[model samples]
Target: MRRFWYLPLWLTLLVTGCAGQAERGDSLYAQLGGEAGVDRIVAGLLWEIAEDSDTRALFVDTDIERFRNKLAEQLCAVADGPCVYSGDSMRETHRHLQVTSAQFNRLVSSLIRVMEQEQIPVGPQNALLQRLAVMHGDIVAD
Candidate 1:
């Protein structure tokens, strides 16, 4: 009876270990459908931001295409995708611009719209958004 119990315990441990490893292997970006998916989401987000009069000023003087590509790359890198994020850090990048929390929240809302439009699976979307949500503190000042 003791030997039987030992075997079951060992099998349970092995199964649990394997499950944890699998979860660990999943990259945030890959879970978001890798590069192609991120591109779609970013494109939609840009469109929404462009149309919003309040947020439009933030992008004035910016080259839309370059900005879009940079954003996609950055998000991909954040998700642990294969791409490298060459952009400056959030604080360094936004320091001169003096972004406000309200503006940041609007931008995040637009991004959420894009994600919904793209129909990205919920689990990855939520996970990515959760990570991004934490950046509000550093990205938005005052």
Candidate 2:
């Protein structure tokens, strides 16, 4: 009977702790200088990927300018910044591509490189990466 009562107390404390941490985490983005910072990171990432021969092939028939713009907007939205993402859903856009996990990992690595270049703090970078990880299932068809 005592153990059952302790369980609820422990669960409540855990929930409250998580809520506090979430609020603190949001402040990290603001400290990093918000939208302008996010844009810089995105631009650098797109440039790096475009320059890489292997990644460039993925966008061979794509309009580079449009792809870059959409990616920036999407990242901004994902980071909880002030931009709206107007791109197609991951499943829809990637359905015809037959992308593999290797391709997805490569793109993630390219983005991480850009984040490092922009000097985004570790916490925000990790937070963003966690969110991106959730999309892997929808993105990598094979």
Candidate 3:
């Protein structure tokens, strides 16, 4: 009888907690560890890209410092963090680069690896990727 009495209270709290999450759903940014996390992700990605032969040639002429800043800004903006992306549009940035689909996939793969190293749970990583995927058309020159 006492266990049954606690059931209703537990149900009430569960419902309230679920409702609160829905209302404050911007936790994705926090889940990524906020600004510091985004910055680390961008840095790790840059290092990965530099070392990965599949995508290294694409950035041969890129100004790395500028690329790093813009990338961090883009990640922050995409994750709904408190930063606006001030970089050029993907099409403009990739213009004249003839980025292959294979290269694009390699970049995505690199990001996944970096996120895993950053200890970002799969869900937030997927959410961020899904959002960023929308820009694929603008990035690949094919």
The model with the greatest lDDT is: 3
Pick the TM-score winner: 3
In candidate 2, what are the lDDT values of residues 22-118, reduced to their tens digit? 7786653463458777768767877877787776667777887887788777777777767798988988877877777877888888888888878
Range of the 10 consecutive residues with the lowest summed lDDT in candidate 3:
21-30
lDDT of each model, Cα atoms only?
Answer: 0.82, 0.77, 0.91
State the lDDT at 139 in candidate 3: 89
Candidate 2 residues lying further than 4 Å off, grouped into runs, are 1-32
Q: Candidate 2 versus the native: TM-score?
A: 0.75
| Clash number for candidate 2 | 0
Off by over 4 Å in 1: 1-25
Q: Write the per-residue lDDT of candidate 1 for residues 30-101, one digit (tens) a residue.
A: 666678889888888888988988788877877888898889988987788888989777777777777788
Q: Write the per-residue lDDT of candidate 3 for residues 1-142, one digit (tens) a residue.
A: 7658889889999999979877887577888989999989988999899899879999999999999999988888888888899999999999899999999999999999999999999999999999999989998988
Task: Please provide TM-scores, in order, for all candidate models, with all chains considered together.
Answer: 0.77, 0.75, 0.85
Candidate achieving higher TM-score, 2 or 3: 3
For candidate 3, the C-alpha RMSD (Å) to the true structure equals 3.2
Error of 1 at 138 (Å): 2.8
Q: Candidate 3: lDDT of 99?
A: 94
